[model samples]
Target chain A: MNERQRARRPGGRSARVAAEVHQAVTDLISERGYGNFTVGDVAARAGVADSSIYRRWGNLETLLSDVALTRLNAQSPMPDTGTLAGDLRTYAAQVACEITGPDGLLLVRLAVALSTNGQQGLQARDELRDERTRQLQSMLDRARERGEQAPDALGVLDHILAPMYIRVLFGIGPLTPDYVDGLVDRLL
Target chain B: MNERQRARRPGGRSARVAAEVHQAVTDLISERGYGNFTVGDVAARAGVADSSIYRRWGNLETLLSDVALTRLNAQSPMPDTGTLAGDLRTYAAQVACEITGPDGLLLVRLAVALSTNGQQGLQARDELRDERTRQLQSMLDRARERGEQAPDALGVLDHILAPMYIRVLFGIGPLTPDYVDGLVDRLL
Candidate 1:
C-alpha cells in the first residue's frame, strides 16, 4: 500500500499500532490521571516495545504534547464571508462547538496537568498559542488587505476570540451563537 | 495568633508545611511529570499525614484545583483611574507583573494542567473569572453612570479583558501595558 492508504487502513499493522497507542494513552490519562501514566503502560497497552514509543516521541511530555496540539490544530480554518462580523461569527461558532466537544475536554485535562511544571508547560503552551495566533493573524491580515477591517483589526480579533476561549477555559457562561454574534457586532 | 497574623507569618509551622508541600509537588511534577507525583510523596515532603492532605483537599484533583485557584485569586484587584484607559493600563500592568512573578508561574502551570480536565477544573476556574469579571463590570458600570463609557460598557469590558487572559493562558504574546492600552483605545 501507498503511504496515504497505509496510514488510513484500519487493518494495516502500523495504523492499528498507532491507533492502539493513541487510544491507550488517552484512556490511561483519563483513568489514571496525567500523574500516574507511564511509558511502560503505554507500550504494554499498545502491544509495542517500549523502545519503539521512546524512539517516536523521545519523552512522555513530547508525546502528550504532540497528541494535544495535533488534536487542537486539526480543525478546519475559519471561512471568510468578506465581512468582519460574518467571519467572526463563523469562526466563533466552530470554536464554540469544539470547546464543548471531546477535544475541548482533553485540552482542559492537559492544561491542569501542565500547570505545575513551570518551564516545561510554558514552552509547550507558547507553541500552541503561536499556532492559533498565526492562524487568527492571517485571517485578520486578509481582512485588512481587503479594506474590510478597522485599523485595529488585531485588537478586535483578540477581543472577539479571546472571550470564547476564556469561557471555555473557565467553564463559565455558555458560548452560544448569540453571545458570539453580540461580541462580533460590538467589536466590529 | 489572629488569622491575619497567621497568614503573614512566612516561617510559621503551617506556612513551612505549605511551602514544603508546594515545593515537593512542583519538583515531582517537573522531574517525573504530573502523572508520577503521588499523595504519599506530597504528604511525606510536607511532614504531614496523607490523611491530613486528603482531609483538607479530598483528592489529588481537588487539592491541585485549590492550590491553583488560591494563587490566582490572591492577585490584587485592579486600581481605579478616572479614565477607562488608565484603569485598564493599570490592570494590565498588574496582570503582566503577576504572570511574570513566582505566583504567576504557579498559576500558569495549574492552568495548563487544568486545560485537559474539562469540567474537572471548571469550578475553580469559574470562581477566578467571576471575581475578575465582577470587578471589571463594576468599573464599567461606574463609567456608564458617569457618562464616560458607551452604552455597551459590558461589551467593552469583555473586549478589553478577555484578550489579556487569552494571551496569558496561551502564552501567545506579552501582556505589556502598551498592548493593554492599545486594546483599550481600540475596543473601548
Candidate 2:
C-alpha cells in the first residue's frame, strides 16, 4: 500500500466497534420503524459490549440521535442542475423519496418524539436543523447568483419542504414522481 | 315553558352528560397533550359515571377520536366572500388558527403515535381525514364553479395545510396571521 493510503488506514478497534453499532442502529430502525427498539437490542445486534455504548451515548435515544445526526451531516451534497427549476425538482424529489419512505420518516418522527422527552432530544434536533439549514442556504444562494431564482427565493425552501412532510405525517405514500414534480412546479 | 320546548327538554339529561365528557376531554388534552391522560381521569373530570364512558366509548384513544370528530363536524360553515381568493384566504386562515395552536398539534401527534400501537389510531386518523376531505372538496368545488380556482385545484388543500403542521412540529408558535396569509397567497 502507498504511504498516503497507509496514513488513512485502520480506523482501529474502537472505529470497528462504532461502525458495527452504526450498522445495527440502521438495521433495527429499518426493521421496526423506531417506536419499539431498545438499547439492549442494539447492543446484542452490534456484538459490542453494552458498556461501550453506555460510556459513549448514555441511552438508546441519544445513540439514535447520534446515528441520525451522523447520517444527516454525512448526506450527499445537493444536485446542481443548470436551471433553478431542474435543481429544485431534483432536490424536492430526492427529499420526497427520503422522508416518505417508512424508515426515513421514522427517523424524523423519532427526533421529534425524542425532543418532547428531554434535552438530548432538543440538542440532536437542533444540530440536525443547523446542518440542514446550511445545506439549504447554500443551494438557494447558488440559484440566486445564477439568476435562475428570484432574489427573494432565499427563504422559500421551507415552503417546498412543508408539503413532503405533511405527506409523511398523514401516511400518504409512495409519493409519485409526477406528483412531486407538480409540487415543485406549483411552488416555483 | 312551551310544549314544543318541553318536548326538546328530554335531551337535557343525556346531552348534558355528553357535553360534560367532551369538555373534560378537551381540558385534559389542552393541559397535558394526549399521550398520558387515562379513561378514569377523563371520567372523574367529566363528573359522569365510568360506566357511562365505557358504554359509549370502549377506550381512551377511541373516545378522544370521537371528541375530535364531533368538534370538527360541528365546526362553523366556511365563509363566503366576493372573490375566490377572499374565500380561500379566509378559510385557510381559519384552519391555520385551528391547527397551529398547542392543543391542535398535540391532538394530531396523538393520533400518529397511537397508530404506532394499533387499529384504533388508524380509525381515528381516518375519520378526521374523511371529514376534512369532505369539507375541502365542497369548498374547492364552489371555487371551481365560480372560476376562481381551476377544476384540478381540488387536491391542493394538503399542500396548503402542510406548512402549518411543519411549523407546529418544530414548536414554531403563533403561526403568525401574516405568515399563513403569505402561504395562501403563494399557493394560489
Candidate 3:
C-alpha cells in the first residue's frame, strides 16, 4: 500500500473502536443507568481494556456525554419549502422521528440525571442545551431569509418545538407525522 | 365546639399529613434520586409513622408514583382573552414559569426516572401527558367555536406547546413570553 493509505488505516481502526465503545456504553447506561454503570463494566462490555477506555474518554461522565449527548446532529438543513408551514411540517416530522428514537430517549435520560446532580451536572446539561438552541436558531434564520416567515420567527419555532420534546421525554403521546403536520399547519 | 366538628377533625389532619408526606417524598427524590431513597427514608423525612405512609401510598413505588405523577392543578380557570394569541401566550407563559421553577425540576427528574424504567413506568407517563393534552385541546376547541381559529387551529397549539416542555426538561433554553407570542402568531 502507498504511504498515505498505510497512514489512513490506523485512523479507520480507531474510528471503529470508538463506535464500538460508544455503542457498548449506551447499552450499559440503558440497562443499568448512569449511576450504576462503572468504567470496568463499559470496558468489559466494549471488549476493551480499562486503560483503553479511560485513555479514550478521560472519565465516566465524559464517556457517557460522548456516547449519549455529544453525538447528535444538532444541525439539520433547513428545507426551502417556500412557505413557513411547509418548512415547519418537514422540520417537525423529522424532529419527532428523531426524538422518539432510542438516541432521543438516552439523551433525555442523561439530561434528567445531569440536571438534578448539582453544579457539575447542570453545566454539562447547559452545554448540551446551548448546542440545540444554536441549531434551532440556524433553522429560524434560514426561514426568515426565505420570506416564508415573519420578522421574528424564532418565537414561533420555540413554542412549536418545545412541547414535542416535553411530550417525548415525558412519554406524553406518539410523535406521529399527523401530529407534526397538524402542528405545522396551525403554528406556521 | 360541637362533638361532630371535633370528631371530623381527624379527616382534616389526615389531609394535611398527606400533603406534607407528598412534599417530603418529592424533595427526597430530587435530592437523592429514586433508586437510593427507601420507604423508611421517606417516612423519616416526612415525619410520619411508617404505617401511615404505607397505609396512604401502599408501597415505595406507589408512594413515589403518587407524589411524583399526580397532576398539581386543582381546578384552575381557563384563559379567556377573546383572542387566540392572547389566550395562548398567557397559558404558555404560565406553564413555562412553572416548568422552570423548583417544583417543575422535581417533576422533571421523576419523569426521567419513570420513563427509563420500561413498560410499567410508561403507563404512568402517558397519563401525565394526557392531562396536558386535554387542557391544550380544550383551549383549541374554545377558539374554534369562537371562529378565532381555523378548522385545524389545534395544530398550532401542538407545535407551539411541545417545544417549551422539551426545552425546559432538557435544559434547552428559557421559555420566555416573547417566544410564546411568536409561536402563537405563527400558529394562529
Q: A168 in model 2: Cα distance from truth in Å?
A: 3.0
Ordered by lDDT, highest first, the candidates read: 2, 3, 1
Backbone clash count, each prediction separately: 30, 0, 18
Say which candidate scores most in lDDT: 2
Top candidate on DockQ is 3
User: Candidate 3 regions off by >4 Å?
Assistant: A1-13, A47-55, A69-94, A101-104, A118-123, A126-161, A185-188, B1-11, B47-51, B58-62, B68-71, B74-90, B118-120, B130-160, B170-172, B184-188
CAPRI-style quality class for the chain A–B interface of candidate 1:
acceptable
Itemize residue pairs with steric clashes in candidate 2: none
Off by over 4 Å in 1: A1-12, A73-87, A102-105, A108-123, A132-157, A186-188, B1-74, B105-132, B144-147, B150-157
lDDT of 2 by residue, A77-153 (tens): 47788777877788777777777554555654765566565676666666655666677677778888887654233
Give one digit per residue, the lDDT tens place, for model 1 in B53-135. 77656666566765555555557465678876677667666666777554454454555555554565555555555666676
Residue-level lDDT of model 2, residues B15-133, one tens digit each, is: 68778998998899767656667888999998877888887687777788778778765553466786667767777677777775445555456656565546777666666666766
Q: Please report the TM-score between candidate 1 and the true structure.
A: 0.68
- Sort by DockQ, best first: 3, 1, 2
